[model samples]
Target: MRKAGWNPIWKWLAIIAMIFLLAPLAIALLNGPGGSSGLYPSPNAYETISNASRSITRLPFDYDTSDDVEMLKEYVESNREALSEIDKALTQQSRVPLDYTVPLDELLNASGTVRLPMRLLIVQARVAELEENPGAAADVYAKMSVLSPKLATGGLLVHVMIASAYETMALEKLIELTPRLSAVEKKRVLSVLTTNARKPIDFDLVRERESDYCKHEHGTVRGSILLWSGSALVDQQVDRAIETDDELLRLRDEAIDLLGS
Candidate 1:
């Protein structure tokens, strides 16, 4: 018997395999590079904030108790310079450009460093209240309201979650403080609340940035494939985050109305 010629079906199978293999590459090419668009504000404030966060003194004590108030006062006073830098960083118009392409440890370190400052802000606010400085306390809460959103701006989902927590803390403080604030301070605080409620976290941008980081870290073709496969899960997460944010905003609106009243 003559040797069988190469099978036509085998040829067609090889062609299909090639198409399947090249599909990702074609998709990646069309999509272009991953990572941040570099449109973020210049002179990134991340380093300043991170450095300040590290320098803050951490005191382990119940913030609620009057006994800890003195310690909290000392903590704030001790970290005065650091807190000042942080305040400047947060208040500046510049963006906190978080380099998402960094290693996981580095990213975690960056995210972790910020919490101390946040905690310190709470302490400072408490001290302000204890000192009968409602205006000062109001300022602290307002700063927190501003700072909370900044924490997640241009950051990943982790940052978004952290920001949400910060915002929650700020909102809670606002609710408690609104009754005590002077009319002028209440109006100012109300303005901040309105601004934050109007512009909730941009989960879609977070998703896009995260997708870009994945593509950058794990070659475009593989990353695109991974992101595409995981898109549904990511979207679900985004939806949940948006819902949570909406509820937070609703609570904020109620607070605004109460303050306005």
Candidate 2:
């Protein structure tokens, strides 16, 4: 459903007054929602990616002391069990949308499973493998990234997964995929990038990416971010800095252009 708004002229004027005002939206509906490389794998692909990553030749016997490999193993095995069911849920075997299809709760049925620390490192190793060999990685991380969001314990894992997706070209094809991410998830992604990743991508870039991908779609993750970015300070200043109310209006109009239903 689209959000109600004033007619274009009024909307544009407000936007001009506060260009950053629309930054809260999560989706733009125009040209967003793809990762770039065009590789949108199906649910089956995801299973294949996750499974193949753990070839008999490259298995992590155990993680650090902070991790419990037994629990991790149980979780992985549980997820694998869901794979057969997930394969049936696919609208397309090669590119099934997995935003909600993968059952995190069902996958976590084991009392012996480790929640994240252990899986995070395992996910990282899989991502590295994806970076080196996409075909194998495709059989490994591409689908794994899609599913990781469901399994992600917090922002750190999400950030690592997103980064790994990009570094590995696993998600190079789709643009607007925050299904695994939340507003909080995005903030975390930004924080981690700002603090750790050698090349940090800021929140603004993330917003821009959503805006770019969505191209003005209503109710999408990108639109939600813009509508609720809550950047009053920045938005207010942007509103006042305009040389003229008319220019302000133009800027507002541009932002509003993104506020479609």
Off by over 4 Å in 1: 1-7, 31-35, 61-66, 131-134, 191-198
Tell me the tens digit of each residue's lDDT in model 1 across 1-261: 898787999999999999999987788788745645566654455666777877876655686455466777887889899888876776454444666568767776677667877788888888988888877887787777677767677778877777788777777777887888889888887776666444777776787778777777777878788888998998888888888788778767767887899
List candidate 2 segments past 4 Å from native: 1-47, 51-62, 66-261
Per-residue CA lDDT of candidate 2, range 111-194, in tens? 112223224334443443434432232233233333432222111222333333333232321112223334453443333222
Q: For each candidate, give its TM-score against the true structure.
A: 0.83, 0.23
Give the top-scoring candidate (lDDT): 1
Question: Candidate 1, overall lDDT?
Answer: 0.75
Highest TM-score among the candidates is held by which one?
1
